[model samples]
Target: MTDSPEFKDEESIRRGQEFINEVYRKMSRIAEEFAAGEINRAQFHRLYNRYQRQIMTVSQMIAESDPSGWETAVKSDESTLHIRRQFEAKAIGLSIYDNRTGMPIETIGDFSLDAELIVPMLSSYRQATAEIFQAGVRSTEMENGQWLCFMSGAYTTLIVLFSVEPSSNRIMLLDRMHRDFEIANAEFLEHGYTSADQLAYPFYSFIKRSPLDTQDLETELDE
Candidate 1:
């Protein structure tokens, strides 16, 4: 893949961070307006979500430019550090859907973030937003302390449900996963393949290996 021109050097990274901070400033302003009852909840929610997507996209762009730099920057920033803990995933999977038909065509997960949650998340998005087609992230509070984080791309979506244990750093992770999905399934996604059996066969094993299971195995080994 060709390198992105936007994030090529230290200067570019600095500019990206500035843009991200500006986006956060807007988010903070929106939050204050919501709290003051100047803007209703719907407007606040929509604008807040848009700003979030902007931050996530910009961070991903920077990370793609300099992964190590992005890591250091995230660690230095307290708010980003906090966010890093909030979006930690227990399991992650890539799923494809047909935007034209509004049907989920394929799912390849065997973890807690099941196929069942997709439609509901999409339904909630439709109910909550004016734009049904915009690709973005959504989170659903599951029973107990788990949260299902959904990040959508062109006609595909990535589902990552976080563990009940406290964790952080989801937005960038979701973006990376979405990018990987694009790279891994470029042909099928481009051609509009709708068969689950055909498209999911290769990734089935990946989705079945939950990150939580790896943690459990590590704990057992330590014990």
Candidate 2:
């Protein structure tokens, strides 16, 4: 069998590793504070959600070696609304929708799709879905400098579109998307959720229950 593609040179890999470690350290500190009750549940949830997003972003950066990666990142701001109750102090806008039914749960911002955008997205989804059906490997596509679509299985697909150019590495983008599907699928299989609504329930519950208390927050000290 052919060997896997070698990553960048040792120095680059080391730098990437250092950056990832720093992020992980920060996440770990937040997680520890959360576990210790130094930070309330809402604060912890917000930090965790942000941390997860950062992990995905970092993974994409490592995979693509691109500095301007956030442009292509899936707009999780739309997902944050569901968890607003958990940390009301933070400004988060994330809306979750049923991939099949097109129904939205938490409407934080408009992730609207026009005909021009939807047509190509659906087409790419279809092609990727067909290929996955035949081959076990997933497929993704980037087109028109604005959209990135991934299809892994009959029931699993992710679409990220941007209003501007994406500075993300293609391979890393697919890797993170694949990881998300794996987690979501595992949860669905364990719970027997037929819709994305069910899959998003835990997050929604967290947000609704965890609204942040700004009164408890201390003002930042001047540097």
Candidate 3:
């Protein structure tokens, strides 16, 4: 990383050294979370990439002030932080509803946001919007910039509320979770009536698998 004339002072380098410690410390939290099974690989990569980009910008400054300090800065950064988790979009709520009666079957996380966002739209959930949802997971932007995403299943609909717009990758993961949830409880879900206790919570597995490991999603290129 070459210096671009901005961070070419002793004071700038000193401040940068301190800041990089904080940044790398944040990275350490995610790294530790990934290792401890608190977060999955995809979530780690998404968050780590965001912070790593900042490293690049800071690298230039460090180089401008003292090229030799770049390597030291890296060593200081990879050291994990003991502080609390700082980043990653919040999984605010998750809800599962009966397709036939449009009644909620189960809910996890915060779904109060759902009551407000879902109720008014329930009336418009008629035939007109049915086709739009047939493809895959669909998301609606909330007033506070949050995202309310839902995927329909054979007998139920799974909705996830997030603090940010879920990425296409995350959507794909939710689709898999929905399919697995339906398959695991197909007999129960397809039956005339069943209670939530009798069914398995495959969607909850989504937290552990977050976007699912890339390798887990891979298949042979050919036979």
Which candidate gets the maximum lDDT versus the true structure? 3
lDDT of 2 at 178: 45
The 10-residue segment with the lowest total lDDT in model 1: 161-170
Q: What lDDT does model 2 reach?
A: 0.46
Error at 75, model 2, angstroms: 35
Show how many residue pairs clash in every candidate, following the order shown.
Answer: 6, 18, 0
lDDT score, candidate 3, position 70? 59
Sort all candidates by TM-score, best to worst: 3, 1, 2
Alpha-carbon TM-score of each model against the true structure: 0.41, 0.31, 0.56
Residue 215's lDDT within candidate 2 is 45
- Local distance difference test scores for all models: 0.58, 0.46, 0.67
RMSD of each: 17.3, 19.5, 11.3
lDDT of 3 by residue, 42-160 (tens): 46776777678657867795676564455465555432232113333456778888888888888876667637668565535534357675655667778887778877777887878
Candidate 3 clashing pairs? none
Q: Can you tell me which runs of candidate 1 are displaced by over 4 Å?
A: 1-89, 92-95, 112-118, 126-135, 165-168, 197-223
Q: Write the per-residue lDDT of candidate 2 for residues 32-132, one digit (tens) a residue.
A: 76555455455566767776776677667667776434434534444444543344332122233334544432332234555475556555656655656
